[model samples]
Target: MPVPAPPAALDDSPSARRREQRGWYFYDWANSAFYTTIISVFLGPYLIPVAKTASCAQDFPGMASDRCVADFDKLVAANPGLGYVDVLGADIRPVAYFGLITTVAVLLQIVFLPIVGALADHTGRKKELLGGFAYVGALAAMALFFVEGDRYLLGGVLFIVANLAYGSSVVVYDSFLPQISSPQERDDVSSRGWAIGYLGGGLLLALNLVLYLQHESLGLTESMAVRICMMSAGLWWATFTIIPLLRLRNRPVPAHETTALRSVGGSFRQLGRTLADLRRFPLTLLFLVAYLVYNDGVQTVIGNSAAFASEALKLEQEVQIIAILMVQFVAFFGALALGRLARNFGTKRTVLASLVVWTAIVVAALFVAEGQALQFFLMAFVIAIVLGGTQALSRSLFSQVIPKGREAEYFSLLQISDKGSAFIGSLTVTIALQLTNSYRIAIVSMVIFFVIGFVLLALTNLPKAIRAAGNEVPDRI
Candidate 1:
């Protein structure tokens, strides 16, 4: 098939712009499968068993009986601290190995994503770049089906690649917001994308959960069922990505582009320039900091909620799964509802309001006692309402403050905050848990993030920030 010609400029006609926006939404629907099924649901648990197999073979050759391989969990419980594998002469727990791999991926994105953003801006090939990264990530996700037995190393490598690609693609994907939608339209457009993504991811996760729960009846091993779910997520991602690649057209390259921006070295230099240039946009920088801090809290809450429920509240696994599914489906409506709220109240104000709610949620979490599943469910519902809204509105609001021609570069910096700041919140939780021996204290510690983020964002001048970036201040904001 012939490649589509890049459009000389964004087609601003309502119909044409709407068509592109619709196509853009599908990319969210596409990539969200990887987030939901692979990252959130299966990979870590699956890899633990694989890593245990290696540990059993190497660390306990005498104990490498059938039961050792089949009942690694029981073996670990019995042995306590002996459940570890030697990797590069270091003893690494299976769970620690997974965390290390994830950290490595985030670090790689920190280094490479800015360069990718610079390249996208220079070449005006974001559509191609987005598709390329998405497909590579999808292929890596698909390869997870082949990881079994003692193949944890292979799984780790594939996960790192897929995660890096996923993060890079998102930077390019977010850069499209300014080009495709007018300032007044960004909140609704971004919210719709997020909402559709939640629906798609939830649908796939629900199906996978059913398949996993029934694997024995279907004559499938649990491992095989998980592997199939991972591959299905990859297939879903790659298949739906075709829509945006086909429908979204690249804007014309800037007419005054310097020759230096045409090569890899140029991209690196441009990234450096972009980093230094950030000082020129104080409100943008402030917003970025606010986003990083609060988003870290949001990520921490979402990431550790299951652990808190399991350990602190003593909720059963089935109840936890039901709550997760509820969050997924409820968040779909939440994004839309909050988008409407932003339309009426302004994006910045709505996001600030969400931050207040986030603060209240963490504080409220401190009081939920063991076996209070109903209270836990109510908390999850409130989290679902704010989770998608905070993130989607923040994305749109940030788009308003970035310089016109440097959208990709600015969004890449935002992407760093999005992907990199989770560690800070997680570390705080770890420290809180260690100091207090209480999961409730650890979870509620996230309230600091929301409080700090709210203070910083509340002080930013949204209309002035928009005007400083050479963009129109939207009527509402």
Candidate 2:
């Protein structure tokens, strides 16, 4: 992409910009409930019992079926259950399956994100695009209410569709950042959005946690409570989205096509041009590569944490839920604090510090023994502090390095590549678990990604990249 002319910067009055930023914050607030309740806290654990029931367990004594399933009742007649049972000749663990399901979902993002991005840039209807994808994903998440006993496949399919929609919606949502705020204000605005997301997600998760813990007393079965939690996330996501949909304005491109097919074709041509132009922005490309590697580690830790706690640490589901709730509230402050830190430190340096913390997190997770709830909770606390900081800062930093006219296109690449990178991390963990039967060893692979990302980010020439992309480099604290 030849460096596009720097567009006139956003010159909104202070109050108007603040209003737009608040609206942007709500989209994060809306979608994160689904991410927290479904992806992070509940779904992985819920799927295990369902998959176990669906497995060939009832036929265990009658005959050796093709896919072996340990009869939970017979194996643990005295205890609650064996942690896992065999399926398809492999000892099926929820963590392993969760990883596979997440991997598939991220892979789907790689296919659709570019097209979504192109359409957003060409059509100038990003708000509508965001809502379209978000609501579809919400519907998919709502359908998870029907994923009952012996329906693991249905759960997996719903998760994939929901996750794909979630990721695609984020691509459009992130592009709005540059439009709402100038480069100088992006870190603060971006961090605020993430903080709001944590609050929203945490608030809803807290309510669902109470519902889940007191299910019997409330005249609801545990399974039914979990189903209701999943359905609630979809409702929460769809409802809050109305704020941003009503407030955000589309950034118009000059002479953009009107027809859908022409718009798509134009998007493809622009995408090709953008790829060729990448070579001119070496620092941006380097940062993308670094983000691709490190974000994978970040995502794997997040995606697998609840499952790891339940399966490896043997924590109760309530304990896992509470721990995640703590993470959400803590991360809310963490993102705000990091935004201030980025003001004092440079964005690159602040993000690199978070990566160091991330590396230590995985290293520490390896030493945490099974059934060590306190140790695991402490580790989760440390993860919470860095999790939002790293992700929020990375998004702000990447926004500064993309060309003026193509925020959506570049952010689409970021969103897709972020998920695309997860494929390897998730696959590595899954394969390691299947082969070695040790999550501790499986998690160590993430350290390599963080270390490499830190080194590359440290070496990146941010000032030059910002200038090359026709963006002003924001001042460091």
Candidate 1 C-alpha lDDT tens digits along 45-127 = 56756887888887578875456766765676688677677767777765445545665676787788899899888777888
Predicted candidate 2 versus true structure: per-residue lDDT over 1-477, tens digit per residue: 455574565547878888889899999899999889998889988886676665444434443532333344343334433435444465465446777788788777777787788778877789889999999999999999999867787898999899999989999999999888988999999999999999999999999999999999999988899999999999999999999998887775777666888889998888777778899899999988888888888888787788788767778999899999999999999999998899987788899889988998899987898888889889989988988888888999999999987888888878974522277788888888766756778788789989998988888888888899998878862
In the predicted model 1, the residue pairs found to clash are none
Which residue segments of model 2 deviate by more than 4 Å?
A: 1-11, 57-95, 417-421
- Say which candidate scores most in lDDT: 2
lDDT for each of the candidates? 0.83, 0.83
Alpha-carbon RMSD of each model: 4.0, 4.8
Top TM-score model: 2
Q: What residue pairs are clashing in model 2?
A: 1-277, 343-477
Error of 2 at 351 (Å): 1.1
- TM-score of the candidate numbered 1? 0.88
User: Model 1, residue 94: what's the lDDT?
Assistant: 58
